[model samples]
Each structure stands twice: as structure tokens, then as C-alpha cells.
Target chain A: MMVVISYDVSTETADGKKRLRKVAKACESHAQRVQNSVFEADLDYSSFMKLKGELLKIMNKDTDSMRFYYLGNHWQRKVEHFGIKKGYNPEGTIIV
Target chain B: MMVVISYDVSTETADGKKRLRKVAKACESHAQRVQNSVFEADLDYSSFMKLKGELLKIMNKDTDSMRFYYLGNHWQRKVEHFGIKKGYNPEGTIIV
Candidate 1:
């Protein structure tokens, strides 16, 4: 199970650039630098937890000016590849 | 079905900024700008084709420094929502 994190940040921090680089460094090889404030990474459960720990340490928690998203697991690609099969009540909740 | 395009550019062009702007304009509302050279868009099949057409017109076919990617459909959210169920031989091709 891998996780992808997307953070929407309002570029208002005095050290936002430094913080962003720190986050990128944590990504190592499981990441693809997508946009300025977005990064795509393939991380397992443990890695996801590790990333969360790292992110929270540098996040600006005093305001809602920043948001974080967690896209969990590689299985998402499968779901994208094949949605719920017909006659399966595709709208029902599914396991990751 | 919407598609997401990721293009990597070498940043060496007389009018790279112009071309990039044109591409961003084509995105309209379904796109999110990420970095200097990356963008993410939720696009349908037809829209993908339209984007392909637009991109090709500005592409420098002579260079190998650029690349494009396509992530298709809104069902992606489902895939991202839930991966293949267990015991389903999840590796087989999916219906998208």
C-alpha cells in the first residue's frame, strides 16, 4: 500500500520554500515532483506514516491556509483501470 | 472519463512561456497548475483528444527533452477511492 500526498499551500510563509524542500527531501525515490506545491509519491503504510510525521512538524497549523491530502495505496491505479464491474452496485463502498 | 496530462519540458525555447500559457488556457477549469513544468487536469476522453491536438501543435518534435503523460477519467477517484477487491486477481486489465 502506497500513499500520495498533496498539500495545497498559500504561499505566505516566510520559510515556506525551506519547508517545501524539506518535504521533498523526505520523498526520496518514491516521489515525482509534479507542481510547485504538489508532489506524487508511491509510499507504503510505514512510509506514509513517516511522511505524515515529517509534514506535521513543518506545517503551519495556526491557520487553514494550508491543506493536506492523502491518496493511499497503489491499488488506486487498479480502481482507475477497472471500476467496479457491472451489476456490482459499483457505488457501494470498496476495500483498498 | 477525464484525463490528466503531465508534460516535462527542457525550459529551452524562444517562446516556451507562450506555449505553456496556451496549454494552460486550454485547461480552462479542469486543470491545476503544479510546478514550472507540470500540470494536472481532470479531462474526459474527448478532452484528452482535444488537448493532444493542442499540444501537438506546439510541440518541438525534434527534441527528446520533453515528455507527456495521460491519466484518464473521473473514475480515477474511484480507483483512488478503492483498489481492486481481494481474490479478484487484481492484476488483470480493468475496464476504466
Candidate 2:
């Protein structure tokens, strides 16, 4: 399954800033950053659950917001993109 | 159908800034702003098509990136959110 995770963490204070970095780093470990606060992850059912649990722990329940879009296996057919940044295939080869 | 539209418009130039406001306004006309550049809209097929056309015209293909997610009628079941900002029901009451 492919999951799209988007989050907004409050950066009004030093604590909020630290949480923001922690959340971003956690997502980066499991997925590729498509935008500043968005990530695309290719994971199995168990992995997705684990990732979600980890993120929930890092985010504040009162000030941060997180959304998970379960794109299923046919996510490619479900997404449409336009403009400068092209859509990336999570399964495709990366030269770098 | 319900649509989630997200965009990132380059603001490196004065013209880009203008386009950014245009894009945001276009989206604001049809949906609720859920984030700086994200919107949630409840529209029929024709309305969705018209909104897409209008946004494409406002955006600069060379510098802006837009994504449209078709959540279908069952979007309520397909989305999960966590934290401060509660999800607004697009079809529910809005009392000003």
C-alpha cells in the first residue's frame, strides 16, 4: 500500500519547533519528502501501522494536525498532478 | 464528490506572488481552506471540472504545482485526521 502523510505542526514555541523536527524526521525515515510537510511512503500493512503509531507519539494532540490518506495499491491511478514538480513513482529506480 | 486540492506556488518573483493569490482565491471560491495551500471542496462532477479548469488558468505551469485528490462520496470513511483542527463536514451546517 502507498500512504500520503501531510502534517502541520505549530511552531509558536521552542517545544513546538522540536516536535516539528521530530515528526519530519520520523516521516523522512519511512518515506520520501514530496513537500515541506508532506511525505509519500510505500509500505506494507504492518509497516504503515507502525509508522502511524510512531508519528502519533511525536505530534502534539492539542496543536498539531496530521492526516493520512490511504491510497491503496492503485494509488497511481488515483492521483493527478500538474506543474513543475513531477509525480514520483515510489517503486521506480532512483539513480542517486 | 469531494475533492482535496493542494498547491505550492513559487513566490520567488512578484509575478509568482500574484499568481499565488489568484490560485488561493480561486480555491477559496469553491472550498474551505484547511491549510495555507490546501482546500476541501464538495462539488458535483461539472462543478469539479469547472473548478479545475479555473485553477489551471490561474496557475503558472512552470512554477506552480497542484494536486487534486478525488475522495469520492465515501471520503468520510477514507480519511483520518489527528490533533487540534477538527475536520469540518462540508455537507453539514455552517452557521455564521
Candidate 3:
């Protein structure tokens, strides 16, 4: 699976640098620097959940924000009926 | 190469219908209807070029516009130095 994650955070937190460090370190395996503060990479489903969970936990209590852009194959919009499969043909995928 | 194409035209063109028709038809083989005017598909590089060329030619003389989002593997940012190989491992790619 290949993933692309681009994120930016408000620079208002006293621990802004610390938070960013935690984020980078936590997602080290699934990401590499893209832009100065943005990172991108690939990971499986379990890694995805773990990364997201870690991000949520690592953020400053209530003063920080984040956004993720999952790019490449193996990426899909979450759906209740059809979650995810190990692999699927990616011809003509309509993404919302 | 998987492609995700979402296009919205400027509504003021009188030939909007014709232009859209051309675009839809040009990309018909590489795409399938996703939203009312949006489409998604997979196509090799040669096919993608043909579709783009057709769209450019069929568009109103000076009344419309278009954009393309090439998605998934085989889809890549144009780079002069690293050109493109038929296939490449897509993990940890640092796309610009």
C-alpha cells in the first residue's frame, strides 16, 4: 500500500515543536518528509489506525489540528458495507 | 494507471453541452460515470494523452476549461530527469 499524508498545524501551541516531533517520530515508519512540516508514506490498515490513534493522542489536549490526504493504491473512502480488501483492481475508481 | 477525473465547467458557455459530450466520449473507454459529470478510470499513458488532446480540441473556442487528477499507480508527476518507467514500486514515494 502506498499512502500520502499532508498535514499542517496551527502554530499557537507552546509545545508546537514538541507536538510536531511526536507526530513525525510516531509515523516514522509510514512516512517521510514531503514538505517542511508535511509527511507522506504507505502503510497497511492496522498501521493506519495505529497512526491515526497515535496522532489523536499526541496532539496538545485541545488546541491543535491536523489533516491527512491518503494517496495512492490501497486507499479507499470508508464505507460501512464494504470496508477494505487486501487488494483490488484500481481501474476507474470514482472517489468522493 | 488509474485515473480519477472530476471536472466542472463554467456554466456560461453556450456550447457547454457539446464540450462536455466530447470530453465524455473521448474518455469513455478509460472512464465510467461516477458523478453527474465526473468520471474515473484506468488507462495507459498513450490513452491518457489522446483523451487530453481530444478535450482540448473539442472545448469551446474560448468559453470553457478543464483539469485532470491522475490517480493511483502508473499515475505520476511529470519529471524530466526521472521520466517514467513502465512500472515502479510505489511505496514511500515522495511525490511533489
Candidate 4:
């Protein structure tokens, strides 16, 4: 499954900024950062759940918001790119 | 077709900030703001092209970037909400 994760974390204070970094780091562990606050990853059901849990723990629910778009397995046909391309491939070999 | 438009406009300069607002305004005309820099719209091919052209004119290609995700007609099944739902429905009726 391909999951697209997008988040908005309030950065008004020092703690907020720290939370933002933590949330981004959690997402970066499993996904490719396609935009400033958006990521795309190809993951199994269990891995998706793990990532979701990790992000939930990092983000402040009171001020931060997140959305997950499940592109399923046919994401290649579903995505279109424009402007500066980063050559992001969710299915490509990840050198982790 | 449901198009998810996400953009990253350089906001360091005054002109860049203006361009960011312009780009966002163009997207708001035809879509729902699902996130700070992301929008989702259910538009026909012609309308999508018009919106794309309008955004291209507003954003600077040299420093700004954008991505469009085509979710096809069955977008409802493709999108999932987590943390702070904004009640966005690309298929819902628009007053305008």
C-alpha cells in the first residue's frame, strides 16, 4: 500500500518547533519527503500502523493536524508531478 | 477527476510571498484547502488544465515547486483522514 502523509504542526514556540522536527523525523523514517510537510511511502499494513503510531506520539494533537491518503497499490497511475521533480519513487530501492 | 495540488513556494522575498498568496487563491477558486499548502479538487479535464495554467503563471518555476496527484473518479476510496478533519469532500456540491 502507498500512504501519503501530510502534516501541519504549529511552530509558535520552542516546544512546538521541537515537536515539528520529531514528527518529521518519525515520518522520514519510513517515507520520502516529497514536499516540506508531505511524505509518500510504500508500506505493508503492519508497517503503516507502526508509522501511524509513531507519528501520533510525536505530534501535538491540540495544535498539529495530519492527513493520510491511502493510494493503495495502483499509486503509479494515481500520481502526477509538476514543477521541480525530486525523482521520488515509493517502490524504488530504499538503502536503509 | 480529483486532483490533489500541493505546492512549495519560496517565501523569503516579498514577491515570493505575493506569489504564494496568488497561487493559493487560484487553487481556492476551484478546490478545498485540505492543508496549509495542499488542495483537493474535483474538476473536469478542462477545468483542471485551466487551474494548472493559472497556478503556473503565479508560481516561479525557478524556485517554486508543485505536485499534482490524480486520484481519478474514485477518490473517496483513495483518501483517508487522520487528526483534525476539515470535512473536505471533492464530490460534494459547491455553492459557487
Candidate 5:
């Protein structure tokens, strides 16, 4: 399955900034950054559950929010992007 | 059609901040703000095109990027949200 994870962590305090970095790092480990706070990844059922659990622990309920869009396995057809930066396929190979 | 619009505006400079506000305003006019930088809306083809064009004009190509996720009309099942804040249906009626 392919999931699109987008989050907003309140950065009003030092703790909030730390949480934001942790959350971003967690997402980056499992997916590719699609935007500043949005990521795209293709994972199995177990990996997806683990990723979700990790993120849930990092974000504050009172000041932070996250959304997961289940793009399924055919997300390429569902997304339309506009800008100079183009998105990379979640299933594609990268040399880097 | 249902569209999910998300953006990342570079806010390093005064001009970038201004552009960010403008881009956000453009999105809010047509959609419900789902997160800090994400929005969801149900719009017709012409309306979607107009909104996209307006946003494109406001965002800088070199410093900003935007994405539109076409969830068709059955977006209710495609989205999975997490956190304290709950999501409202784009098709639902709002008294305010």
C-alpha cells in the first residue's frame, strides 16, 4: 500500500521544535519527502502500522496534527503536481 | 470532483511570507483547511482549473511547490486522519 503522510507540529516552543524534527525524521526514514511536511511511501501492512505507531508517539495531541492519505498502490494516477520540482515514484529505483 | 491541495511556501523573506499568505488565502476560498498547509474541497472542473491557475500565479516556481490529489468524488474512503482534530466532510453542510 502507498500512503501520503502530512503533518503540522506546533513550533512555538523548543519542545515543539524538537518534536517536529523527530516526526520529520521518522517520516523520512520510511518515505520520500513530497513537500516540507508531507511524505509518500509504499509499504506493507506491518510496516505501515509500525510507521503510524511511531508518528503517533512523537506528535502532541493538543498542538499537533497529522493526516494519512491511503493512496493504495496506484497513487501515481491519483496525484497531480504543479511546480518546477517533480515528484519521484515511490516504487522507482534511485542511484543516490 | 474532490481535490486535496497541499503547499510549501518558502517563508525566509518578506516577499515569501506575503506569497505564503496569498497562496493560503486562495486555497481557503475554495476548500476546507484540513491542516496548516493542506486543504480539501469538492469542486467542478472549471472551478478546480480556476483555483489551480490562481494558486500557480501566487506561488513562486523557484521557492514553492503545490500538489493536487484527485480523489474523484469518493474521497471519504481514501483518507485516514490522525490526531485530536477530526475532519469534516467536504460534502457536509456547514452552518457557519
Candidate 6:
């Protein structure tokens, strides 16, 4: 499955700032950062659950916001992108 | 259908900034701003196509990027939200 995860963490205080970094780091470990607070991850059910758990632990329930869009296997057809930001195939090769 | 629209419009130039505002305004007419550049919209197929057309007109093909996630009618079950941001029922009432 390809999961699209987007988050908004409050950065009004030092604690919030730390949490923001933690959330970003957790997502970075499992996905590609398409935007500053948005990530795209291709994972199996179990891996997705584990990633979600890690994020839940780091996010502030009262101030931060996180959303997960389960794009499933047919995400390629469901997502439409336009303009300059290059789109990547979740199942394609990366030469990095 | 409920669509999740997100965009990254370059603000490195005056024209880019103008386009940003235009894009935001167009989205604001049809959806709710969930973040700086993210919006959630509830629309039928025709409305979605119309909005997409208007947005394409305002967006820059070379430096701006727009993505649309078609969540279909069962979006509520597919979307999961956590933390402070309140989720709105697309089919619910708005008392104003």
C-alpha cells in the first residue's frame, strides 16, 4: 500500500519544536518527504501499523495534527499531479 | 466525492506570490483550508472537474505543483485524523 501522511505540529514552544522534529524524523525513516510536512510511504500492512504507532507516540494530541490517507494499491490512478514537482513511482527504481 | 487537494506554489518571485494567492482564493471558494497549502473539499464529479479546471488556470506549470486525491464517497472511513485539528463532516450542517 502507498500511504500519504501529512502533519502539522505546533511550534509555539520549545517542546512543540522538539515534537515537530521527532515527528518529521519518524516519517522520514519510513517514507519520502514530498513537502515540508507531507510524506509518501510504500509499506505493507504491518509496517504501516508500526509507522503509525511511532507517529502516535511522538505527536502532541492537544496541539499537533496528523492525517493518513490510505491510497491502497491503486494509488497511481487515484492521484493526479500537475506542474513542476516531479512525481515518483512508489514501485519504480531510484538511482540514488 | 471528497477530494484532498494540496499544492506547492513557488514564492521565489512576485508573480509566484500572486499566483499563490489566486490559487488559495480559488480553493477557499470550494474547500476548507486545513493548512497553509492543503485543502479538503466535498464535491460531486462535475464540481470537482470545474474546480480542477479553475485551479489549473491559476497555477503555473513550470514552478507550481498541484495534487488531487480522490477519496470517493467513502472518504470518512479512509481518512484518519489525530490531534487538535477538528474534522468536519462533509455531509453535516454548518450553523453560521
Give each model a TM-score: 0.49, 0.76, 0.37, 0.82, 0.82, 0.76
- Candidate 4: TM-score of chain A is 0.80
Candidate order by decreasing TM-score: 5, 4, 2, 6, 1, 3
- Which residue pairs show backbone clashes in model 3? A92-B41
Please give the range of 10 consecutive residues that has the lowest summed lDDT in model 2 chain B.
B87-96
Cα RMSD of all models vs. native, in order, equals 15.2, 5.8, 17.2, 6.1, 5.9, 6.1
Candidate 5 wrongly placed segments (more than 4 Å): A84-96, B86-96
Q: Model 6, stretches more than 4 Å misplaced?
A: A10-21, A86-96, B10-18, B86-96
- Our model 3 lands, by Cα RMSD against the true structure, at 17.2
The digit string of per-residue lDDT tens for model 2 on B1-96 reads: 888777765455888767766766776668876655567788999988998999899888876778887777877776788876644333321222
What tens digits encode model 6's per-residue C-alpha lDDT throughout A1-96? 988887865455888768766766776668876654667888999998999999999988877778899888888888888876654333321222
lDDT of 3 by residue, A1-96 (tens): 544443333334557656766777776666654333444456777787677778777765344435444454644441011111111112211122
Order the numbered candidates by lDDT, best leading. Answer: 5, 6, 4, 2, 3, 1
In angstroms, the error of model 1 at A57 is 3.6
* Tens digit of per-residue lDDT, candidate 5, span B1-96: 888888876565888768766766776668777776688878999998998899889888776778888878777898877765644333321222
Give every prediction's interface RMSD.
13.0, 1.5, 17.9, 1.6, 1.4, 1.7
DockQ of model 6 vs. true complex: 0.63
Question: Residues A1-96, candidate 5, lDDT per residue (tens digit)?
Answer: 888888876565888778767776776668887776778778998998998999899988776788888877777898987775644333321222
Q: Write the per-residue lDDT of candidate 6 for residues B1-96, one digit (tens) a residue.
A: 889887866455888778767776777668876655678889988988998999999988877778888887888878888877654333221222
Error of 6 at A48 (Å): 0.7
Cand. 5 TM to true fold: 0.82
Output the worst ten-in-a-row residue range by lDDT, candidate 3 chain B: B79-88
Clashing pairs in 4: none
**Candidate 4 overall Cα lDDT vs. reference?**
0.73
